[model samples]
Target: MSIWISWMVAAGVVVILELFTGTFYLLMIAIGLVAGGLVALMGSGHELPYIVAGIVGVAATLALHRSKYGWKKNSDASQDPNVNMDIGQSITVKEWQDNGNGKFSARAMYRGALWDVELVAPAAAAGVFTIVEVQGSRLMVRA
Candidate 1:
């Protein structure tokens, strides 16, 4: 087929990939493909169309990366119950001992993993404790 047809075909493939990926990043490449296709149809030299396409793709993609559209930060991911189910879940401590740091600490089994737990302020004597928050592999607890 013609050079322009090739470019259009590539653009269509990228657009289809963007749908599956749920990210608009491939759309930026599609923009460049369309640009190159236009130049190819205009009878530009072989190298010129590719150069224009690369420049347009890179520039447009960078512009998109800098924008706060698809590149947004979700502040709720930290607090979302579905995202972090262990936040409100309970943890059981065999014993709460003050190894240091004033607050009581213990090694407890949570989700089949041994976690270093720190009881908030006045620590519980022992037994079942509710998980207040989790930072890394450590658990912050409240009795």
Candidate 2:
């Protein structure tokens, strides 16, 4: 088989694999292979060596991935309401409990189940407490 036909077949296979991986890296390599095939077709004596094409494909893929989806150290805080929805929900304290480690108690009717609660202030009375923050399933409260 001709070099051009072989390169084209290889490029087509890489592109098909790219569809499964979805990482864009494989697609880049496929593009490089297509370019090599084109060079072979054009009879450009300056054919891209397979190793050089592979390296170029990888570098291009990485650069594109970084520029398009890289993490930013200074990204703006998320504005989604789901993250801040628990700020002011009223919760009922289930027991009269206290400790020297600030204030703590168990609460019922919170986010579905009884929860161990802690607060920055003492809630001596067992009743409803406002949820100020949530740490996992535990609620931080204030009376």
Q: Write the per-residue lDDT of candidate 2 for residues 1-143, one digit (tens) a residue.
A: 87878888998998888788866777788877877777777665644646556766777777777785533355322322356676677877757566656556665676677776776576577777877777777777789
Q: Estimate each model's TM-score.
A: 0.53, 0.51
After superposing candidate 2, which stretches have Cα over 4 Å from the reference? 46-52, 68-108, 118-143
Compared with the true structure, the alpha-carbon lDDT of candidate 2 equals: 0.70
Residue 129 displacement (Å), model 1: 26
lDDT of 1 by residue, 1-143 (tens): 99999999999999999999988779999999999999999999999889989999998899999998657776654345668788778888998877775778899998888999988758558888887777777888888
What TM-score number comes out for model 1?
0.53
Q: Against the true structure, candidate 1 has what lDDT?
A: 0.86
C-alpha RMSD between model 2 and the true structure: 6.5
Q: Judging by TM-score against the true structure, name the best candidate.
A: 1
Worst 10 residues of 1 by lDDT: 73-82
